[model samples]
Target: MKKIKNKKIKLGISIGDLNGIGGEIALRTFEDERMLDFCTPIFFASAKTISFLLKHFDIDIKFQGIKTAAEALEGKVNIVNIFDDKAQIDFGVETKESGKYAIQSLKSAVKSLKMGEIDVLVTAPINKSNIQDDDFKFPGHTDYLNQELEGDSLMFMITESLKIGLLTDHVPVKDVAEKITVDLINKKYKTIYNTLLKDFGVEKPKIAFLGINPHVGDGGVIGQEDKEILIPTLEKIREKGDLAYGPYAADSFFGSGNYKNFDAIIAAYHDQGLIPFKTLSFGKGVNFTAGLDKIRTSPDHGTAFEIAGKGVADHNSFKEAVYTAISIFKKRKEFKKLTKDVLQKQKRRPASSRRGRFE
Candidate 1:
């Protein structure tokens, strides 16, 4: 990990679906003065797209180009125009031109992240079907990014009060069963455990894993997934000293405040976790990408294309996403500081005693 001086986290933005409310919400989130205090927001879209979005929404925030994060002015918004080519950034109009631009913007943000130009990334919603390239695959940003990073990245629909993590996102119901394996469960739990401890400052973060089948397989009468796959994984993790539990019944887990009892909930599939989750935090929930090398967040909702140019889209989820990214960046910094102090103290102790003398 690259270490630098403690400053506000710089946000690298990907403006998705310029025809939709993505640009509007991104502009609104950037215009907030409080957000500038936490981090400098940098837009990875072009000048034309920015102007089109602002004009469509009729917002009066003036933005300009900046060479680097340090060049961002106090009052004006900072933008890094990434695209060299130009397209008609039409509002309420969806075209391959728009789709291609959206893909380019997202790709540029990923490149910036790899180069360490920004500390965290906050994306607006994009339609998966819109992005049409021969090589472009994956249903959503999370999947595309995870494949790019070449590791397991869990999708968590987040609110401060509760969190729901999906074991399988954007997958067919029939395929979900084949996807759930002991190794996958163990990997996801490890990611959740490490994230809660590092990002949330929880010393012994308790995360519960839910079952894939109805009534948690009811001892294999309903399904064998819980009994054969999930249980063995949970047991192995517990034995390794991770604070994890449950092959809980999917029916009662959320309604019974089971999610409230833990730091995070891991579900068997997408709808299983998100159904109850969205019911609780629908317009307010933020989608977080965990287990990536870079911190990333986005509004859980989509680009309400039907409501484009109407000034009717709710900005709550986008606002929450930006704030969530800032908070995660801050917490990640703290986690690093705490880990460093811990290691330094360990270095001071006798090697033998440090090994045997548990804290």
Candidate 2:
């Protein structure tokens, strides 16, 4: 990690579907001048499009137009003119043009992130359906980033109090069981454990896994997946000195308040985790792509076409996404420093002094 001292982190922003609430929320988030004190924001969109949105939404704020992310200045909201042409802004509809522009913005911001021009990335909501073409064939941002980034990507939904991860994301419900093999479970669990340690600064984290069947197979009377697959895998994980527990029934896990007991919860499928997470922390939660080399986060909510240009969209989640990305970036830097210091100290110690007896 690059050492950053006495300087604000550069935050890269991708303007999602222009027809959706992406532009509105991005503008609303930086409307407060105090946000500039934390990090410099660079929006990957043209100044003309932003100006049109600003006028349409009736917001009064000044922003600098820069030709590149490297030209971003601290204490000012910057716009990287990814395109020079004027965009057609359809407030409450998705179009091919909107999709194309959204992809352009995302690719530009990601490129800057890969080149280390930006310290972190907080993306706005994109209409997943329209943002697909020949070049981009993934279901969503997590899938695309999994290929572009170094480490495995886990869709980790986080709030100040609650955190939930999915064992299988963007997979059909019928295929989820097949996807949750021993290797997949081990990989996702290790990713979550490491994310808790390095990203969230949690030490000795305890993770709970939700079951695949109702009542955890009701002692093998309901289904065999929980009894056959999840149970044995979790047992093996625990044997390896990891605090892994449960194939608990997913239906009542959140209702019974058992989720509060663990550091993080891993759900069997997408809806199994996100339903409760959104119910509990809607408009406040952040979707963090955990176990990735680069820091990326986004608002938990998607593009609200109904409320696109109404100026009524809530910016809390987007703001929290920014804050979370910055927080994780700082935490990773600190963790790397601490681990490096520990390794240095161990290397300096003599072999005779390092030997210890269990007795």
Candidate 3:
């Protein structure tokens, strides 16, 4: 496949929890010089943090530290320090200090993103519990991205074979059912549908919906949500000239190999979707926040505090996150070009020669 951006795309990296594996996996990802051939990476972190990781892990890679994205060099890992002396790294533990620094890194990268200084963003993991402050009251990264970018983003999990989108992310299990309304369902469906086509290059994407209750409510014995809410929602989606099917039992859908026939799956809640996805692609899945104006992706795993400084943290998912961000960036650009070309052609056609709207 072609590199996401023909002209070197600038990728912004946000350090997650400084106390965890965010810096370790991030630094490890760029260890090889060949990584720069595809895109320029700017780490939104402090020199103190990166240097600490380097010495702690005993890594020998050098990175360019710049004040702004404009100074990012081609074929080199760049660090845009967002914190200085106030920043501290405490490996294998989560602290308020780490959380504050994580937010700082994210805010810095977000500024660069808004200025159009970076093409894509690949975030490291953040401890949801620790990262919560007045500035970050949301549950996690997806919430922050949605609020900042002002888009109804979906927690779209991607692997080589399957893509799963969640209806309600980071919600309590008891509140999950109450959150599933027709409007929310339809909006999420539309976002996932458009993302599949524009960001993933999937034409006529097939979306499968998972039932909320066991055996799809067992014909109202288990629950009424499947028959009452989700079924009607899917019908409405299909009527809009889109291919969507299901309200299928989640367990059977994946086990029966039925998901392979679909382009994406829409799960009712967080665990309902992520559990299966992680089971299948645990070490290599990329969590992509779709429907936002800017591209943002992250490794499927969390901080992995237990193995923070061990230098044995698996970088597969993080690596794939970077690759996926690049791919989506390229696909979106191409989709826009195709759309513009089509519009231009329609405009160039003689008015009288054009057929009626229905025709």
Return the top candidate by TM-score. 2
lDDT of 1 by residue, 121-232 (tens): 8888887787867867778899888977645799988899898888888899999999988778867877777777766677888888888899889999998888888888
Pairs that collide in candidate 3 are none
Question: In model 2, which runs have C-alpha deviations exceeding 4 angstroms?
Answer: 1-5, 349-359
**Cα RMSDs, all models:** 3.5, 3.4, 3.4
Q: What would the per-residue lDDT of candidate 3 be over residues 237-347, giving only the tens digit for each residue?
A: 788777899889987888888989999999999988998899989989999999998999999999999988888998889999999999999999999998888768879
Candidates ranked by TM-score, best first? 2, 3, 1
Residue 279 in candidate 3 has what lDDT?
Answer: 90
The CA lDDT at 323 in model 2 is 97
Candidate 2: lDDT of 130? 91
lDDT of 3 at 117: 92
- Report the lDDT tens digits of candidate 2 across residue range 1-359: 99876889999999999999998998898889899989999999999999998999888779999988999988899999988799999888989889999989999999999999999999899988999899988888999889888899999999988999999999988898788788888889989999999898888899999998788889789878888888999999889788898988888899999999999999999999999999999999999999899999999999999998889999999999999999999999999998888768878998676642111
Window of ten residues with lowest summed lDDT in model 3: 350-359
Q: Report the alpha-carbon TM-score of model 1 versus the true structure.
A: 0.92
The clash number for model 2 is 0
